[model samples]
Target: MSQPPPPPPNQPPQGGGFGAPQDPPPGGFGPPTPPAGPPAGPPQQPQPGYGYPQAPPQAPQTPPPAAPAGPPQQPYGYPQGPGAPQGAPQQPPAQPGYGYPGQQPAQPGYGYPGQQPPYGYPQPSTMPMQPQAPQGRRKLNAQAAIIVAAVVAIALIVGGGVMYAKSSDKGDDKDTSAGSGGTEGKNDNEGGEDVGGGGGTEKVPSSTSAKVLFQVPAAEVPKKDVWSVAGSWLTDKVYAKSGVSEVVGYDPDSGKESWTLPLSGLTCAGSPEITKDGVAVVVAEDAKRTKANPYPDCTEVTAFDLDTGKELWTKSVAPGGGEKTAFKEVSITGTTVAAGSGLNGGAAFDISNGKILWQPKVGSCEDVGYAGGEQLVAVRKCGDYGNEKYEVQQLDPKSGTVKWSYKLPDGIDNAKVISTKPVVFGVDSGEITASGATDVFSLDDSGKLRAKITLEDGKYEHDCGVNAVHNCKAIAVGNDKLYVPTKQHEGAKQYSRVNEIVSFSLATGKPTSDRADAGEGYEIFPIRMDGSNVIAYKNGPYDKGSQVVSIDGKSFKETKLLETPATDQVRSAISGMVPKSSEMRYTGGRLFMAEDLISAPYSADEKDYAAIGFGAK
Candidate 1:
């Protein structure tokens, strides 16, 4: 290492470091030279290798080994420091730079580019260097280059921070690359708008104009038969059951005819239930069919592929002598579709081959339906007719054997099952009375009584064409609780007060949220299920009002989701006033749910029909 030329005569070396004092620079160490303009950036690390306050001074020795020849190209990684072109002719070495003993060569400071040296500092040598050993030059250049790289790296990082801060201040996304998810908002279909999916615009309020997916005009089909329409996202089509012995399927996306298959000498015996695999329906052999008695003949079961309109298979089902609708209610599981008859029994048919799977010894006493996910469940009269015992049987689909059975308790006074999931809701005899036993019992998975609730004063059982459990608007499950319509049962305590819509916890049968809504004379009925909430339709005595409410299941908060179908024809269809000729659900879609709003074309006018819509947002 070269000695930093010794300090002039009288002044003691100012502690071995870069600022060591000289004896008055031919005059005196007057004022310390100002660091050329404030530092261009955060303080540079004392020019790496320069002697620190504690570092020992270099021992007197020959000058540092010369840097190798064959000049290295300017580094390509970073923008060059401002001054001369990066590769400009190397200025002669000035003050010695600090580094491993013999590694670094003396060079001008790169800080404050283009600035003159501080007073008393040695001037950069204008003389060119003598050629030296290539190996030695390489070592010297690499060490010096490292110090330059460090300063460059720090500058770039600080620059990046400033850029990001500026972008945020401008209220734009910082990520500027394509598909960087920097856009704000989205179409209604791409919801989460706030919650799920991706970062986008907030969803429009329910009051805003809805983007209609599709609406089928009423004039195309008979007004009375308008409601036979049913839709399913699984099958991706709108389905309708014509009483005249045929089923029509329409594409949900465009409302075009997907396919229409005839029943061949049979009438729709009951409302059909559809699954992605196929559609299950009960029909009557053409014999006893009449305008008044739709299924007066014997029973027949049919399965059709809504995807292709091909008849998968058909089976003759006779629930036995003179029983009504022996093949009425249809449900599907795995590969088997089962149809339950009035009282005779339920028969499971192979969904693919139409072969009978199995028949149970004991048949469901009441209408048979599905329960507990894919299992079949029904209320069956177990004891002799004189004694009359009723129990719910969870049946095995393969052999029709009883998987488990839960019997109704005595004094419960005739509780019939209404829903099988979320919770087992039973409709007991008569409206809620003071002395009456609990008409509604919430049961857990093991069939244990979880909680008991009574009905409201005016919430009596009524036979609404669509849903039989009219006391409650509709059966909706949210946040592990079953929400139902209930009035303050007579003499119940404050904790049990469920005025309009009551939430019964499926696990414990306790009231979780005070989630109920209604205005005078107009009670709220949950008509549709949204994510984890229920969309409610406010129905009063005379007509269906134009208020659509949504209740959050978790919080039990209610928000006006949408205005009721505004068109009179659509309103009439929703109200169920006009006679619907068909018996099917018309509304269907994935991102959206649409329905034929009117039962038929408006007869008073000429040809006009409508439908209502509700969806993701």
Candidate 2:
């Protein structure tokens, strides 16, 4: 299939490391744009439903002077009404899908040129509807003579700090050996015992309703810059979140800070996977930011125990004693810690001792990022600028050996690994959708492509972070299926919009008939898989509180797990944490949500929340 080329040689570098970032719309990025072309037919305007944000009100219109009565002249030169004889202002075409109740739908010209988002497609917005942060560093623009030049700038400009900071993995380096030893007191089971998927320790409660346990206030940041707080995780007893320059562990039940693991600088990226024993990895800067170096390179990699808040080891790579190597993301498969970059290549380290296991030399090819869990998968970039190709490879976690590799089609600039075990990933073939994907490809164990599920641009709604491979939201994988939420559409109630969670089979790449509905004013999205079942979140309309539910993988039945308070304060707190851009975890009847980036407040009265936790008895 023909895919969209990356920014032309003359264009500036886009921000995403997986691909390149496109600047968000000026007023703030809204929903995905509708696909190009007209809809099959006009549908009724949809009203804002539960869970979705309401649109801002418009200025009250002043009544035009009474029209002169001459053969019933049209009023104020307005177009004839749809059914009226003439000169009656026609009602605006029903807004696409669900719209803010009583609010005028934004006129066309925002997303793709179209009549409306088709069934199963997303409706674009004219204004910012949700609070979100970019996954990668802010994209900067540049001028170049050709597409190749622009592509090169992508590495130099966007790759910036990361390009200068990759660590050398030469076997003879004394630093490699010196940094491999653990710094903290060692535990007997550190390397010997297996800790499969670290969560799922708490028991489910009988009552599905929940109460807010606590809310963490955000730290005051400089008005000129935003700080990255990109990671959060849940264990049986602790919920860990990234702070300014530390990872704080809070008692899950009381929301009190139990422990803090300080870092050399600001936290940049974190591994989503944790060992059964609560060991995880994060990337930070080698030094704190200063006016001279407003944005320090993220070079420090630390492995720590989440439960005890113990720092096992911290290491940074500086090839040939040059600038320290910086990493944009990290992952763990078994005991191997894999850190990747788009410009300098990638390296794997021993999770137990921080030993340099392997660091591949950068040539025409580089490992851009990795998705780790039961398998360690790398998305490698090869070829030259303007003619680059991407290959997805399954690697041996300990040895960094490529077990198998699958090449993406040419012209496809980016891809994200959604699931490693099932070997499923998404690609933005034409770069036409806001979700950064146009199709999903599923592969067999041998790396043979099985089925391709077309998203048809914005027809389906889902998101995988631009810079990181494993940072996907509103999606779940289980029972040989991939689950995604449909775009919101009109519900049974007047002015109400709702959405549903549907699944696509990995073996066939076709959507199954089953669906879990969010009912009349809610939008349902999957969080993660709990065994064969899917844990989901339902965004409620203004009057109702949001909910967490578990959907049976086979039957598609939903069991309510928890619901937040519907009071205005609680509603604002819970609804403001959108799943697409927020760090969220729901495990063992406990739900935690946090922001990825906290910027200076826009106004004095505006409240800032860093994180919030909820629990059921």
Candidate 3:
């Protein structure tokens, strides 16, 4: 046998040398290796302690006996193969372009020396970093958006509500009538049809024929100098010229005579006053024809029905022994009617009947007595001749019992008491000084003075030369405001044009400083306070010429000026020359004025008076 030809290169060695461990050349038994570096690969036997099995020397090599069946064993100096077991199936030798143990594979398009994968194999993809929401930011933005929208919505809603409320309020204040002066039955600019004669005494026009809509004439023969006038709403009539005391009803719209109630045996010196329920209470003297000595002895307090001109009741109040006495001033409020005797204090009566309620003795020569809520305030002159001073006394409305008295300061020539709650007094100097003053005093229920307010200190001076405090002609209180009017002096002539009207706050006693110059030749009478409007007469640029002026009580501004033309007149008659006396009065929604002219026919000596009515336009 030829020595077996030195076993073929790849075959195992013969028998007994199998265990001979002369270290094989680095690559284990094989043909002499070329200089191309030891077989390009990891070492066949792992380093000691690497946990790899030792390889047999001269052992048959069949692809290096595939690495143990399970995961390949870990090599020394390198971490165990990821997910590989201590002993496992060995992976095939890395393909071209693949990496050796512990080495990364070459990128698909790149080559490491000769290592490279076959073309067309896909490379592992790198996943993009997953996007993440900013921490807490999304939730925070959602909340902020909601809050912004809510704020905007609330602002819009509030603004819209305010606008709507303002519009509704404006609509409520608008007046819907044609114009301030539009007449009910006439075209906008056209005047009413003339109904009666232009001048001379023709027949008295009937209500249907009268151009004037509302008028009240003297029910009884008119007095020579009428000082005061009063009206009753229940009866729709007026009591005029006290002493003659005529009660008349005229159409509120046409001024034509409606009815007349005559008081034959009565005379009044003061303005007739009406009760809240519409009864007329007047201080009157017995008719001249009925009693010869009617001055003091026959004086009586009379209550009359406004509707029928019927006397409701009468009560005679005379000093001891039925002595001749005169009751000067009479006033009526809600529940009581009171009269002040010129020299005696006052007496009150039940408004429901004519029964006497109370009679309290006051000082001598009382100027005026006023009836308020449940109290009576009287102004009287005290002391003896020439040195007399005035005093104000408070009395119980129901019992006529004296509550208290206040002695007025000296030098007070004349004084008037206006109201009770916030008592006001208008006192004039006894001297020739043009200065006058108004003093406000607060009083308790028992009549003690609580506070004193002096309204003005100097002479009354205005553009028209009338001093308000000194020459105050009229003072009235309404809606808690005091209205004082002073004569406007134009040189020697006292005219309404120069008249000044001033308002004062009753509670504070401070002048409102609201002054209105009513223009030249117009007199202002504080007629009525309706809501915020004050109704006053703008009388006499001339006798028959008058206008109605409505003032804003709050702003003291003139709002409405209404002109009413008098009926035409004929020439030369005494009546034609004697201008009509126009009077103005106001109620809830209406203003009424009476135009009366005493006429004497030109050719006849006879005298007659014609009355007409003028309604507020």
lDDT of 2 by residue, 229-266 (tens): 76787766577888889998877766668899999888
RMSD of 2: 18.8
lDDT (C-alpha, whole model) for all candidates: 0.36, 0.59, 0.37
- What TM-score, computed on C-alpha atoms, does each candidate reach? 0.51, 0.69, 0.50
**Local accuracy of candidate 1 as per-residue lDDT tens digits, 191-286:** 221322212222324233222233333223332221222222223334333323455555443445667667654342432234534454545444
lDDT of 1 at 403: 64
For model 1, the run of ten residues with the poorest summed lDDT: 159-168
Leading candidate by TM-score: 2
Ranked by TM-score, top first: 2, 1, 3
Best by lDDT: 2
